[model samples]
Target: MTCKKNMVIIRSFKQRPVCSECQMRSLSGPVSDKKFKKLFDIDPKFYETSAFLRDIRYQYSLYQNLTEKQIAAFKRVVDEFKNPKKKQINAIVPKAPTKEEQAEHKQKRAKGLFQSERSTLRALRTK
Candidate 1:
């Protein structure tokens, strides 16, 4: 039941060959290779996020050597994050009003004013 005994038993059990994984677990407790890989597996597009770069910068600040070119590159990256590129929006432009429409609007306004004046005159006459 103990790991040391399990390792010894595993070593003796040559008839039913213990897998390397079982040997490792017996020696070093339960360690999942899949979980380890999953934890450290970096995506190809991870650099684009800048988070991975930031982590690296934070973790290995002492190891960093910034030349003029490297400093410029870092500045560019910082600028990129500070002022991100704007995506082109498909904006709907309103159609300009035609001369005919302007004329029609003027006529409507004039008619409204004329009707109001006529109503006031009628009211005055009746009084």
Candidate 2:
């Protein structure tokens, strides 16, 4: 296997191989602002919906103060969540599937045993 970041032959675990250096670096400490931004380019709704943030808010409520670095990190996450990069916008936009492809997907889905009653009815109708 190869490293996702550098495409070098991974010298890490076989289950989920990554570069040894990359793995070590990731495990060391808190991610940098630029790295954090690149990693978590999620929907703006995430700022409101994140469970981690909820936990942090609860902690803050009890403590009344967070460290400067923690506050800065929170602000950074909120800012990034609110305004996703242009590259992320393009990357996230998936191409529309054709009607034939959609039909094929429905057919494939219908063949599965574990599905809702609605799907069962649709499968029957399709037949």
Candidate 3:
């Protein structure tokens, strides 16, 4: 990540990451609403810049006040809640089954062990 100001040089092996102290001191004092707006008032030279980076920086500033352990716990909780394995959000509308799959599904449905969607399934044999 490149800083807007040439404050630090990041290297692969030897350089330390930007310290939290430096981050807090970059634009000092408790962030008031006016100060927050001032930090975000970028040079109007660029037309309609996205506020994504500014939003992230604001979040970072707010998070900086938390203790190191608190930050760790916050990260842990976010990770826990964002588990990829637990992702199960699905569309309410089901997809149409393929011809081969429809045959298997029909068999299962006949045996009363599976459910077929209300939509008619394509058949492998016409007659």
Candidate 4:
């Protein structure tokens, strides 16, 4: 019988590796003309400028705050036009709701339903 010393090596085959540039691209919402210039050191063509601006605004609004790591990443992109080789920025992965959190959410939803029911009952009683 042959024994495997590194289970990770076997498991690695099952998972696909994603590059940092891809990860950054995924996290980035959109680049504005100004931001695009800052990051890429090039402006969008005259026709595409407005659309590019809108996209950047949308992305900024969508992500309320940029983390330090994200900011550093932005800077890093500006420093080097080439794709980042290192995965310095940690991807934000939302955690699954815990049992307690799920229960709390359910309780809040139930309370909202109860409030609506009570309001309806009061309205019917008044009429």
Q: lDDT of all predictions, in order shown? A: 0.48, 0.56, 0.46, 0.48
Which lDDT tens digits does candidate 1 get at residues 42-114? Answer: 3323344554243333323334333455545655666676677876554555677999998997997877976
Ranking by lDDT: 2, 1, 4, 3
TM-score of each: 0.26, 0.31, 0.22, 0.22
What local lDDT does model 1 show for residue 72?
57
Query: Residue 23 in candidate 2 has what lDDT?
Result: 44
Error of 2 at 6 (Å): 41
Residues 1-127, candidate 4: write the lDDT tens digits: 1223323222456442433333234434545456543543333331133333333333454664445665565555434533436654546556789999999989978779768888999999999
Where is the poorest 10-residue window by lDDT in model 4?
A: 1-10
Report the lDDT of model 2 for residue 103.
Answer: 90
In Å, residue 74's CA in model 1 sits off its true spot by: 0.9
Off by over 4 Å in 2: 1-47, 88-127
Candidate 3 on 1-127: residue-level lDDT in tens?
3245546545566544543334434534455566445533443221123222333344556664434564465444434544635444555557778999989978888976633333223233343
Residue pairs in clash, model 2: none
Residue 60's lDDT in candidate 2? 52
Q: Flag regions of model 1 displaced more than 4 Å.
A: 1-49, 55-60, 89-127
Steric clash pairs (candidate 1)? none
Candidate 2 Cα RMSD after full superposition onto the native fold (Å): 18.9
